[model samples]
Target: MENKFKKITSLWIITVLILFVVAIILGLLMRFNQGGNIKLDPVTFYTDMTIHGLTMIGIWFVAGMAAVNYIMERYVRTSYKANLIAYIMTVVGVLMLWGAGFIGKFHAGWTFLYPLPFKIMWEQWATPLFLYALLVLGVGWTIWTVSLMISLLKKYTLSQVFAWQHFKRDAKPEVETPPFVLISMISLVGVLSCLITAAALDFLLLTEYYSNGGFINDALLMKNLTYFFGHTLANEMLYLGLAVIYELFSEVSGRPKWKTSWYVAYAWNLTLFFVLFAFLHHMYMDFVQPETLQIIGQLASYLASIPSTGVTIFSILVAVYGTKINWNLANLMFFIGTAGWVSGGIGAVIDATISNNFLLHNTLWVPAHFHTYNALGNVLFSLGFFYWFSFQLKDGIIKDKHSMLKILLIVIGGIGFLAAFYFAGADSVARRYANYPEEMASGKFWATFGGTFATIYLLGIILFIGGILKRCFGFVFSRV
Candidate 1:
């Protein structure tokens, strides 16, 4: 069973890395086109955008899911069959989606926001095919998430799984819930709910596409549902990475294992509930939404991150500060990823505020924060897991003689790339335009700057990929 898990995970890591590198190039191409260094027609540009965004989101979410599924097997029996099913479905679904984008010329900008799919801007058949593709991926992931959650529940009741006994001071429970288990449970439940939301949204989309003017969707409601799935799922996947860090960080650092304490339980519980409503922040620009809901969005955005981030950072610092422990690439990635997550979390909170949203909504500020956390934060977490997992398959550490140089390149590249985005965002650069007009010379300059740094970042990722690939190849052929 362990061997099976390792092999599948190795394949997933390799596949994800390959796709990720391509997506990064697509993004760089888009930036270069915006900078006027490359010329791509509007249709082609948006087409690349659709594929890049969708592929990045899909790969990272699965990377997190794969990591958790692999790690969870230690405590609970996992369903390898379901894992295999998800793998096959994901592959087929991505192929169909790619066909819609590349062959059918469907370019709805990844969001596929309401009524846009019906615009018939691209091939007539592309829209429905895209929706169907999402449905395929949604079904497989929903099943996988629910199966894992059920497996966890079978071992422990809801209260036990959530570590609710820790809610009280000086309480003793017969079963101690690992921090990883609690977070994974919370994140899986979040993922499951959002998948259902995605299903509902897709259903409405398909209905409208086929209704022949008999049905229409409420734009506001669709937008609400869209971000509910998009934002929540994006964040939940990050939590999945955090779950792996919780389980492995202390051990990798040669410290005592992290235990689920009262504060830990409370913080995660707050996250589980608060994260559901936090997506409302994305709707702030829609004047149709009630002020009350907007207020809720701001509060949710703040509440969601404060407790969890505070507790996790505190725990991490406690584990590291004034203590002697081992440091390796995996733990270093987690540590640096935490800094990135917190930094982006701060930027996100600022943007979530209503007053600030008026100034920053739809600006590059949006992508800046998301890219910060995702590119630097969650991506690093999963990469760290890949390094750890691949080595496990190969039975020892595959020493990288250029470990320091690798860290330097990644840090320099990632920071410079993000810095360009931040500068562009603060200069009021709009998001999603293929090119800037003469009046927005700063936009073009920043686009070029961002493209250059992103290329450097890509180089760093390539180096890391080479290292990961060597171990992955060993894993694929190793008997273990």
Candidate 2:
């Protein structure tokens, strides 16, 4: 079972890295085009944007899910057939998606915001094909999440899985639920909700597309549903990475495992509730959304980040602050990853505020915060897991040499890249523009600079993943 877990995980890691690199290249091209370093047709640029967004989101979400599924098997049995089905479906979905975008020239942003997909400025066939691709991926991922949830329930009851028993003082629950199980369950439930919403929205879009004037979707509702899935998945996937952290952080640092307590239980439970409404923040400018919901969005955004990030950071600090601990690449990645998550999250909160949203609406800052969390935060979390999992399958942190140098590259590069976005955003650089006009010349310089630093960041990822990948491949192919 352990060996099988390893094989499946290694395959996931391999697939994620390959697609991630491709997405990075597409991002670099976008930057270069914007910076006047290179020029791409507007259609080509948007096509790249669509694929880059879709691929990055898809790969990272799967990476988090894969890690949790692999780690969860330690406590409960998992369905290999479900995993295989998801694996196959994901590949097919991605292929169909790529064909639609690249071959058929679907230039709609991965967001595929309503009315725009129907605009049909691109190939007529691209619209329906693109929608179907989403259907394929959504079904596969939804099944995978539900199956994992079922696997957990088979061992532990719903209340136990949620760690509701931990809420009471000195509560001796008949069964102990690991923090990993708690977070994974919370995240899986969120995924299921968001995916269901995604399916509904997709159905609406398809209905309108096929009806040929016989049907229509409410634009506001579609936008609401879109961000609900998009924002929730983005945040929930981060939690998925955090689940890996809760499971591995202390263990990798040679410290004891983190136990589920009242506070931990409270924070995650609050997360599950509040994050569901945090997506409202994205629609704050719609003007048509209820003012009450907008208020709820701001509050939910704050409450969600505060309790969850606060507790996680507090736990990490307590575990490492005065202890003689094992600090390897794995633990270091996790530690630094937490800092990145908090930093990016703070930025997100600032933007969520209504007053601030009025100023920063749809600027480079939008990408700034997300990239900070993703590139530096969630990506690091998964990388940490990959480092730990690969070495556990091979050498147990034997490749500790030049670790500081690698960390240095990642830190310097990430900070540099993000700084560009921050500065450009503050200067009011518009996002998603293929080329900046003479008025936004500074945007060009920043874009070029960001691209350069991102290359450095990519170098660090390459060097770090190099050995991990070798070991993973070896493990994947090794005879049991």
Candidate 3:
């Protein structure tokens, strides 16, 4: 009989794949209509994009956390009360959000920014529906978090080393906090701040006080909280993904012996502390926010990025030094993905510079850098992890060569498309618009070229999805 824990992991992976494909399709189409000023297509645009973002977040980050929680629980033999409930809530919450957004019944983005509901841009029920979905999703996430932590506490028996020490060297490191826990802690704060931000917005909606001149103040407050959560969540994914990559790579290659493990962990922990304060970078272009706030944000933003980038590059080099590195598809992706991440980081630092932000804000440059760094960087690592785990499963089955080829094509095509977008952005193209003006003809040309590559990228996705289906239905359930 298969283990219950293994079954959960499999389910989560399937969920992640469905969400990933949805996100990719939406991403491509959104880029395709880059020049049009269409807010909602009145049918598919708002809901599809909203669901795409939220579900991708849940599947990629939230569901990944669920899997991690399950793994930790299994390691510690934790109880499973409400475990099934947690999964159910997550699925249901996503569906509700999708239905609301797609059916034209509601059209809020995943962020559901302030003054959204009071402004009456969409249906009256959108606010309530969104709040309900939040309630359901939050419960599920809280369950997973509590379950994992309590189980770990029992296993460690009040000792900080075993309880909170996510990584240790020499098999007896003397620290209580580790990078994983610190990231988790930061994520908790991010989530809470977002929730509070949502609550504040909800209050305005209920009272309709925005027409009474509360909009500006509320917007700023909400913006502050939103950016805080947004920046931290994005940064946390990179740090966590890097940690996982370092460990997995070392284990696979059998080198470096985990000597620098604590330093890497410490880097992530301290780095996030700086990330929280860097929220002001988003406000660099805002008119009302104080100049001091912007300066503080820029400083924190630059300071935070240093440790993460430093730890990742130096550690990977030391780990791989003098080793006969294998060129498996997954390993290749990891190495290239790291490079993409670093490139994005460079763009990010530049964007945070006050003068640069003035020129870059609201331009394609912003999305170009972020998509390259967070979407491509973090998601690519996650994909690598998926491939690695498939091979590592006790079933001992590996993805076929056809699957590997598809992944390679997708990576190549996607990067080409994104690079073009970056160039367009640098040339002062704006995002979220459907049609380019004559003033930006050259930029639009390159952007269209990039969009063409994206359409081709979908072909690679089809191949990858087909391979997965074949493996699960034809091979896994077939007679060995």
How many steric overlaps are in each model, in order?
Answer: 0, 0, 8
Q: Give the runs in model 3 whose Cα sits over 4 Å from its true position.
A: 35-47, 70-83, 153-217, 254-262, 392-394, 397-404, 465-480
| lDDT by candidate, in order shown | 0.91, 0.92, 0.63
Candidates 2 and 3, the one with greater TM-score: 2
The sequence of per-residue lDDT tens digits that candidate 1 reaches over residues 293-322 is: 999999999999999999999999999999
Across 1-480, the per-residue lDDT of candidate 3 in tens digits comes to 234554555556566677777787776666555534224363355556566667766666654464344434423565455566667788898877776676535655666666554455666666667767766876776666566556655644443422235445544555444434444444444444444544554455445542455444456776776677556656655654664565456655545434335566666666646877876898887779887898899999888888778887887787677778654555555666788788888888888998988788877787778778755577666666666655544464544576566766777777878788788878888764555678776566765677677767677766655544334333344344
Tens digits of per-residue lDDT for model 2 on 73-152? 89999988888788888999999999999999998898899989999888899999999999999999988999999999
Candidate number of the best lDDT:
2
| TM of each candidate vs. truth | 0.98, 0.98, 0.83
Regions more than 4 Å wrong, model 2: 395-397
Worst 10 residues of 2 by lDDT: 392-401
Cα lDDT, model 1, residue 157? 93
